[model samples]
Target: MRAILLIDDHAMFREGLVLALTQAAPDFTVHAVSNGSEAIAELEAHSGISVVMMDYYLPDVGGSALLRRLRQARPGIHILVLSASEDPDDVHAALSAGAQGFIHKSASSKTLLEALHGVIEGKQIVPDTYAAIDTNGRRLPQSDDAALLSALTPRQIEVLRLVCDGLRNSEISARLGTSEKTVKAHMTAILAGLGVINRTQAVLIARRAGLFGKPN
Candidate 1:
């Protein structure tokens, strides 16, 4: 039997998907999971599962990074992404990280099933539309785009730019209309996402890489 795993966060959605798959192919045993980490654990626990259908966004692990890890752990396995995000950069990054197929959650149930069948038939897919933007989801700078832009998310990029402008956590919170803790968390994630040690370094590096130099 060709085995598969379904990874999504919503219980209702997972249950509905499981029902649909089992009804469509009774011989196919579909295991369901809640998030990327659990899906990783499931992959480790279950051998011979040939396909993985997952969402791109998870509370624990983000898209591109998770896709890379999944590919590294299960080379040659077919992976399909179902997401609401249509960010062009995200699409490119997911494909680059080794996702075999991509489909938006907004696709009809029939379309989703067809996409799954297509992947099973060795076809690659992506949404027809998406455009890359800066960390704020604004148009990325035409020139001097930072090397770090590839690493940081739109939210983290916003926080990093504010930090470079010498905004303190409280000031940043007020300016961005976010909580101080949230700003601080973004700062931390910005550093880790950039593979840097601290925010000060993160700002300087982003500026040097030319991402922060662009006008809003």
Candidate 2:
């Protein structure tokens, strides 16, 4: 049997989801909780839980921190975060902290189920908005671009531009005449300087800061 542990503070919505999930998947055993503490206790009590479906905002704990705690408790558990926020930072932070998928609360129930199934099957799921931003690469003001890019060193900027071009780390290393390890180190600094948690977010912020080109 597939088991799901859901953590959300809203009582009506949480109960509704539990009912909906059980009806949709007869083989699923869904357990519901309201906060971080209860979630921890439920997870500890139920060793068979395969998926954790949680709200990104909690009254008691921050999203990334709770995600980290859950991951530490169960290394192999699959986690999916649901939120009303479409913020790229939130999406990247959840993924960076260990969530396999992030779904906005505005999504249809069908979409949410599909994401859950995908995560359970070992797939990483990101929203269509993020995909669009990644593909289009929009530009912002020149001053803003200069200021954000200024945080990165010349080498870091070079590495980031290559990443924006979709080059793999190994390919970047070859192009820059550096080891893959060094490229990875540069990437870490780039992410920190850009205030993002992953390459996708880094690219989006770069585009927003006009790193790619002048505004269209």
lDDT of 2 by residue, 1-216 (tens): 899999999998899999888988889999999998899999999999878999999999759899988877776788999898988778767866778778988877788888888778655667756643432344322245457778899999999877654455876898899999999999999878766557766665665565663211
* Backbone Cα, N, C clashes tallied per candidate: 1, 0
Per-residue alpha-carbon lDDT of candidate 1 for residues 1-216, written as tens digits (9 for 90 to 100): 888999899888889988988887787789899988898888889888888888888878758778767766766677788888877666556655666577888887788877787666655555533322333444433344365567778888778766654345776798889899998888788877765554434543564465544211
The estimated TM-scores of all candidates read: 0.58, 0.65
lDDT of each: 0.70, 0.78
Best by TM-score: 2
Candidate 1, residue 180: how far the Cα is off, in Å: 46
lDDT (Cα) of model 2: 0.78
Please identify model 2 stretches exceeding 4 Å from their true place.
134-216
Alpha-carbon deviation at 58 in model 1, angstroms:
0.3
> Where does candidate 1 clash, by residue pair?
135-154
Worst 10 residues of 1 by lDDT: 128-137
lDDT of 1 at 152: 76
